[model samples]
Structure formats: C-alpha cells, structure tokens
Target: MPITSYPFDGQDTTETQYSLLFRELQDTGIADTYGGPSFQVSATGAGMTLSVQPGFAILRGHAVSSTAVETVTLPDAGTSSRQDRVVLRLDPAANSIGLAVLQGPDIGQTQTDTGIYEMSLAIITVDANVTAIDAGKVFDERRYAGSHVGIWTTNLRPVHPRRGRLGCNTTTGRWEYWTGTAWTDLIPGTADNTTRWNGYTLTVSTSTPSGTPSPDRIWIQPTS
Candidate 1:
C-alpha cells in the first residue's frame, strides 16, 4: 500500500504541513500578549504618526513575536477623509517579514497576492487636512482567529495535554472536556469510550472523573 504521511521520522516536512499543524494549534491571527491584545495599532500623534504595540501572532505557519514597540509614520492626510490599513506582511520570495501601511480609499483592503501573506492590524481614518490622529480615528481591527484553543477532532488532540485544556471531539460530534486525565463528555449522559482513532484507546466518562493520566494515549498521525 502507498503511504503518504506527514511528520514521520526522517521525513522532510513542507510548509503546507507546517501551516496545517499551526492551524491545528491556533488560528492565523493575533494572540493575547501580556493579558492584552498583541500588535495593537494606535495613533502616536496628530501628524501621521502611528504606533504599534509589541505583540504576538500566528500568521499561517509563521509565528511573529515582537517585544519592542514599532513606530510607523504615514504620509500626510489627503484633501478628503480616506481609509488606510496597517498590515504585517510576509514575503516568501524575499524571505522577509515587515510592516506596511496600505493607504487608499477603500476600507479594510489588505494585500492579497501569490506567496505574500498579510493580515490587517488596524484601520485608520485620515480626515481632510487633519493634524492630529486621535484614538477615536484609529479603529482596532485585530482579529482573534484561533479555532484550536479548546477544540479538536479525532486524531487531532494535543500530544502533550495540559491541565484545564478543553476540546471538542468533532468525529463523535460531542464537546469533550479533557480533565487532564480522560476525555470526559461535557454533554450529560454521553459516553465516548467506544470512540477510537489511530488504534489508541481513549477513556470516556459520562460523569466527571478525576485521576492521574491514563495509560492509553492518543498518538499523533497523518491528518490527510
């Protein structure tokens, strides 16, 4: 039989697989940093000066973690109020990553090109002949796009499960709560002990169960 699997020993991983892994872990967007939104965009002054707060983001398979605040200076406002977008761009050809402001009349329009990944941080409204860009003018457009925070499907559970980590088993169509031990069914009276994947036995309980980790474990497999 022909076997096509990812993340095997001595197997070279591709960017597409890395993207899938990242998507499985978290969504492609800004993650909370220091108990607040990461990569916050705000106006530094009235004269086209903008400030981006340090933050972290998972763009596709790439992880961007910035500790120093970045300053971006935009051009002077035009005669009419126009919309501009601040974005974090990823260029695969140049193998570089940087920030740029897409200034135009359209609102929330970001860069969309082949091999170039970009995400909008904020949308700022530049008024006609405005000298000051107030906080009200700068709208926070950061998207929290993590779908894997507390969600999982069959064969997609965390390899090293952590305490208080909750997930849903989509294969069984049930919200499974991982109580740092077994996969407990959050819905009342539902038993998932019969649910099996990759030949691994999973402990399912209808009621809340607490104990040490089970011997039966779910191993990671190809997600094709």
Candidate 2:
C-alpha cells in the first residue's frame, strides 16, 4: 500500500472500456511547462521545432510509445542536445517571433547566461483534424483519427485511451490514473499488491527483470 491505489487499478482484463482513462501526461509536473501537437508541425527530424493547433497546443501520447524521448536530440548526433531542462514557450500574439526563449540548465552542466533570449522558433497555429482544447475542456485523448497533444516525460506514458485503468509515472515513481473524471493514485502495495524490498526492490529468479531495482519502478504481481 502506498500514496493511493484507487488511482492505479481497475480494467478487469475482460472489458471493452471505451472511455480513455489511461492517457499519458503530456508533460511532467516538474520544472517544465509543456503547452502545445497532432503531427510533426515543423518536421519529423532533429533540430526541427514542433508546433500544433491552438486547442491541441499541448500534446500527449502513449507513455511507452517508441517515440518517447528522454532528451531532445539535435538534427546532428553530436552537435548538442536540446538539453533536458529547456522549456518550450509559445504565444500566438508575441511580436518577438513566437515568444521562444533560451533558458534553463544544460543538465550535468552549469546554467547558461542567455537571460531569456528570444529566437524565431517554430510557430504553431492550428490543425484541421485535431480539435482545440481549452484548459479543463475534457476531450477524449484517443478520439477520432487525429493527434492529441502531450508532454515528453521520462516514463512509459502508455495510451490505453480507455477509462478506469491503472497508470504509472516512472519519473516520480508513482502509480495514479484518470478515473474517467479526475486523477487517482493506486496507493502502492495494496491488499495482494505486495512489494519485496531487499536493499532495493527484489525479484524472484527466472522472472522477467531479475535483480535489485529502482524504488521508483512499478511491479505488478500476477494471479494464477
């Protein structure tokens, strides 16, 4: 049992739950504020700034999708990483070319002295397929044949796109999920959900992952 289990368990393993209760968090709740894409608004490569429609300004996808990235890679392999802490700022009405700024630390490096410098970064307007979402305007994350906005957090932001399902945020190492209306945490190790700790989360030999694990790792016990 942990912070909350009600937020991270449901889906009876035999139901056609159409309500999307397992959409991933588009952005992490950390120091970054990701507000923004259905497609590669800019281009589908490195050094390419992404944009999206107004309402779909922020994007989210399956937490564990193959496209999930830990750090923004540059158009060139060794040129330079977009840096982990850099936040993408956008404003449709800003005159300084898309209200983009260069700030934040370089991750494993000292802070830059740019001091809020503006650049002509990629500008995102709107898309025809994806409907725009206002703050708290509840829309289905997997609705229609369009893209939904999301963040690039460092975990498996899987898109079960259905309601009343369990979800885990690996970065913060917690399990909470959307309850069709709001988010709920499935307090760790509840009832039969027991966790074994031997210096670290241990494992039974011959299982999948066999060794000491990070405390933030999520483990599900199977019932036979």
Candidate 3:
C-alpha cells in the first residue's frame, strides 16, 4: 500500500497495459544490476572439485596473491552438465596468476579466464556460454526503502527465490532468475560502484517487490 511513479507515470493508461509494461521492465531488471552468492571455498588446490551441488558456491581469493600457480579448482559437475555460477572477487592484486574457472565435467576440463582491471568483478554465466565478464553496477537508489547489505551464506539454491526476483547466480555466475515463465540470464559484467551482492532495477515499480525483499530472500538488484 504505497505510491510509485510507474503506476502513475500517466493517468490514461489501462491496468492491463501497465501490467505488460511492468513485465517487460521486470524481465530486464536483473540485467540492469549485478547480483548472487553462496558457500565459500578456498583458492588453494589445483583441479580439486569443490563440494558444491547444482546450486551456487563462493570462491575466496583469501586475497590469493601467488602468481605462479597453474591450476584452478572446479565443482564436481558429475553428469548433469548443468552450469554452476561462481561469484569471484579476486584480491585486487590477483594479477598474473594462472587463474581460471574449470568449465565442465572433469578437473582436467576446459575453463574460462578473466581480466579484472584491479578492483573489478564479474557474474559468470556457466554452461553453454562459459562466459566471464566484469560485475555490473547496482544503482544505490533504495536508501529510503530500507538499508540493503551484502550476502554471506553456506548454501544457496535457485538464486532467485521467486519470479521476477533477479540476482547473481553463483551457480550460473550471471544475472538470472525464474520468471514464473522461464529462466533468464542478463548481460555479463557490471557497471561502476557495483562491488557487492545485490542487483538494481532500471527504475522503481510497485508491481515488483522492492523496499527490502521477503525474509530469507534479499533484493540484490537495486534501481536508479
């Protein structure tokens, strides 16, 4: 029970048209913001399979500074070939290291590497794309809605708990969500000032869940 600009953007519009307009915006919301997280793993072994299921898992650089190592850890993908996302934030100085993500089924599998310009980050969309790019910016425009913060967890499933709820999938490593119609992944990488685990919407909408998400569900996406 609150007022939003979207609904009243103009008065002559019908509710049905507004609903369609809202849906279009909802679908693109996540792409506009970088988001997601999960269980933490260490950056110490080469070709070791971290115990992350078909969901998400975090890989800590431990501020990993060694630049001579040659192997990267991967998840035990087993037989599904299901892509799992990894939210990686290299120690700003994680340069020149033989760093990369193990792409598929085996430890000796293929992998994707990243190029962070110092403090940059990315939301890697796993599977078909095997892509890696800089994290997107989550515009901080919800201060009055409530104070949203970063996420730290041991188990993360279905990065987006509900439809239109966009997020960074540690399992998919990209902006994604279940739209109650289909699963969608947004643009890879992020904009400036997007250094946390939340997403941003293109604009505010009352139809969408804003002003702090439901319990256990955090709104990683923010809007301008």
Candidate 4:
C-alpha cells in the first residue's frame, strides 16, 4: 500500500485584507496561481521590495510618494522573436510607482506641396549707396501684390533722404530701380548688400501746356 499526502488549506485565514490583496493580484494576471507567492521578496529596514517577471503582465500597488516610479526599456532581440520589455520601479517617499510599455514600429500616411512667391505683396526700400539687392532680400513689383514686404536700410545719417525702391528679377533673386525711364540695378550679383538710400532729393514742378494738361507731376525730394 502507498501513502499519499493531502494539500493543506488554511481554515483560520478569513477572506479579509491579505486574502483580498492576493486575489486582486491573481485576477490581474500578475500572479501565476492563487495562494502562491506572486512577487519575489527582498528585505530592507525602510520598506518591502517586490519583483515580478516580465511576462506576468499588469501590476497594481499603492504609492507612498510621487518620485517612487522608475521605468527602463530593454534591448532589441531579433526578427520573429522581438522582445519589447518595460520595467517599473516604485519609491516610498515620493508616493508614486513608475510604469513603462513597449511597442513596435509605427505605420501611417503623409503629404507635401511646393510653392514659390506668386504675387507682389510688399515694398522693400534701400539706400543710395547700396550696390545691389541680392535675390530674395528685396521686394519687387510682383512681390508687392503678394503678402508681405521686407525693408533693408543701411544709411548712416538720420536726415539723409536718398532712399531707393526694391525691385525684383524674373529669372533669379535680383532687384532694380526705375530712374524715370530706365531700370537701374540697385544691388547686383548673388550677394545681398545694404538697401540704404542716402542724400537723394526729388523736385516737383507744375506747368500749363498750350492746350489742356493732364495731371500734376508730383516729385519726391531728398534732403541734401
């Protein structure tokens, strides 16, 4: 005849705080089985230490402080068996527990468009001494009808009045000015220079023609 030992179940232990805690852990899948040791225990005088296996899944605990939580990510494993691991640490003083989660590559969609300055939106003003208005630095007539204008001033004297207009090039980033009839390059070349207009004056005169005249010629003046 063979003798068999029966499993022992505690009768005195009622389903109270400790039993409820254990059941909660078991229900959350943190523990392998009911009435079994769920967390590995380490001892310190200050507080208790609990460690759980990675695959055990969800965790629940009361935090004593805010800074008690700490999380760490694991290294990559391989193709078919990729191991995304997360670790949580709890601290007592801060009354908080740290949590971490792992995931795979992201999948989504995207779009794009290419557009340049199509209309004139602003007026750029430079000084007389400026040799050239580099591309994109000054405003042109086409740019005036667009959205915004940029002004580059380089004149030293406060009262000097020879300010120039900002012009644009159709092919590239270049600006020119209209001196009554001809278009003069305000700044030349690819390099942008100062748009300072200094010491230029405009004169205004009204004359009556033999017949009927058109409108009056308004001249702009610069202080000499």
Number of the candidate with higher TM-score, 2 or 3: 2
lDDT, candidates in the order shown: 0.72, 0.31, 0.33, 0.29
- Which candidate gets the maximum lDDT versus the true structure? 1
TM-score of every prediction relative to native? 0.60, 0.20, 0.16, 0.15
Better of 1 and 4 by TM-score: 1
lDDT of 2 at 10: 62
Residue-level lDDT tens digits of model 2 in 52-154: 2322222121121122322222222123223221223322234121213232222232212222222122322222233331222112121222233333333
lDDT by residue for model 4 (56-128), tens: 2222322112222222222222343222222333333344434332322321111111111011111222223
Q: Where is model 4 more than 4 Å wrong at Cα?
A: 1-17, 20-66, 76-81, 87-224
lDDT of 1 by residue, 1-224 (tens): 98667888888998667766766777677776322547989888657888898887877667778899998987788899888889888776776667889887754544443477888888888889987787888888787654345677778877765444567777888777656567777775645554566666554455434555566654333344
Candidate of highest TM-score:
1
Question: lDDT tens string, model 3, 72-133?
Answer: 34444343334333333333244332234534333232222322312112212223322222
Q: Which residue pairs does candidate 1 place in steric collision?
A: 46-131, 46-132, 46-133
Between candidates 2 and 4, the TM-score winner: 2
**Residue 49 of model 2: what lDDT?**
33
